[model samples]
Target: MSASRPLEGKVALVAGASSGIGAGIAEALAAAGADVALVARREAELTKVDAAVSAHGVRTLAYVADLADENVPQRAVDAAEAALGPVDILVNNAALARTGPIHDTAPRHWAQAFRLNLDVPFLLSRAVLPGMRERGYGWVVNISSEGSLLQAEWSAPYSITKRALNALTAQIDLENRHLGVRAVGICPGWVRTDLAQSPASLGVPEDELLSPADIADVVLWVVTRPSTVSVGPIIPVRPVSKSAQTVANWELYLREMRSYDTSGGHLIDLYGETR
Candidate 1:
């Protein structure tokens, strides 16, 4: 659209792009002149984003694929390539967060969280990396959470998987640094998205939360930076807390108490004393 667009002629694939942060990022990329492929589970939601991206004067394709399904990532990538050409940019923004005491969490829930949060990104990266490496240019941005660096109570699976994802981001960067492919982890603190307001999440009001568009702006800046200057990691915090460790631990303690029994009285007391 605009002559100053940094991403002119580039192609991007944004996973979890039906809404929230993913949609915001997709729209921004399109505005910067990148043809985009929007991926999500719901075709209706993807259509909405596709319409908006197309209005920005960039080619847009809507592909519905459930990231939870192990085989879906490759299929989605293939379809995106067919529609928009080789992916020059990829945003692994799809994720799931489950908050509950480790002992109280069911095995199935843990598996689902791992698959969605950790496995999906890993698989999608693998699917798109080869083509990127061959082209001698590509950008992979992994959307992570601040919870990864904190020991959040009741949110064992969320915190664990995010931490692992961050580690995976670094590993990818190290391995592909010389291949013209770059990876970075974008960790945002509390964004006001539907997922953040869900019954299972900490319901921070929209007014008090970081807007998805805000995070998307940062993503655009990072990916559009000079290829010679690689941005390895970036953290964007809203209402910036001094430290997240204490808050995470306190939340964990309260969660542990909810599942405590008579035998856990001593453990509860210890947690109280520590807090």
Candidate 2:
């Protein structure tokens, strides 16, 4: 591998690549010379991102599909493999931002959140694991959230599913470590995406928000590290500004976590606010 283009021959499949962090990650991988497959529901946005990645002189494939279909994960992987080869890096960045008080949320909403936020990654990982194992090298990066640790009020679905994602990351690592695949979960705090800038995040400090590039840099570093370095963990990349609030809320967040219903979910709107 060239030092300037460590991922020169790598194939990376990034879900939720229509925009924001997903787009950023794809760009970073392409800059490192990785052929990229961008997957998301927006054909237009995917095409735009595909163009940007191709500018880096690497191969690019766009698979437009809503992962909520359950069957979409395998199909997405199949398409990527056919065009770009078996995935060397898989970034499970697709997520549903379901927000609502756990006690009053509906069961179907919960099901939807779990299906997208948790199940899709599990399905995608399953579809790609065999090839990665045979090749004896792969990275599965789960883009969890800082909310997973906070479990804040009125955000039950989002928080719990992400926490479960972190657990899934550990479970995947435990099972696949010996097979030469690594699973790393990243919990980013207040990324400066459109969602973070929405009215819902009113009191949030803009300057403290980490850029998608910040998260992408960390992911790139994680995947390129020597295999012997051991980097498969649920890492929390919180903004320093929010750390104190998280610490203060931890006790309350946990104490009341189990006292309410866990089946209701209110989905995030276009701007990422629960409506």
lDDT of each: 0.79, 0.83
Instruction: List runs of model 1 lying over 4 Å from the truth.
Output: 1-3, 198-206, 234-236, 241-275
lDDT of 2 by residue, 53-138 (tens): 99999999999999889589999999999999999999999998877677777899999999999999999999888999899999
Query: In candidate 2, where is summed lDDT lowest over 10 consecutive residues?
Result: 243-252
TM-score between candidate 1 and the true structure = 0.85
TM-score of each: 0.85, 0.86
**Candidate achieving the largest TM-score:** 2
lDDT of 1: 0.79
**Model 1, residue 76: displacement in angstroms?**
0.4
Which pairs clash in model 2? 105-264
Across 71-127, the per-residue lDDT of candidate 1 in tens digits comes to 999998899899989998989998887767688888998999899888999999998
Best-matching candidate per lDDT:
2
Model 2: residue 203 alpha-carbon error in angstroms: 4.2
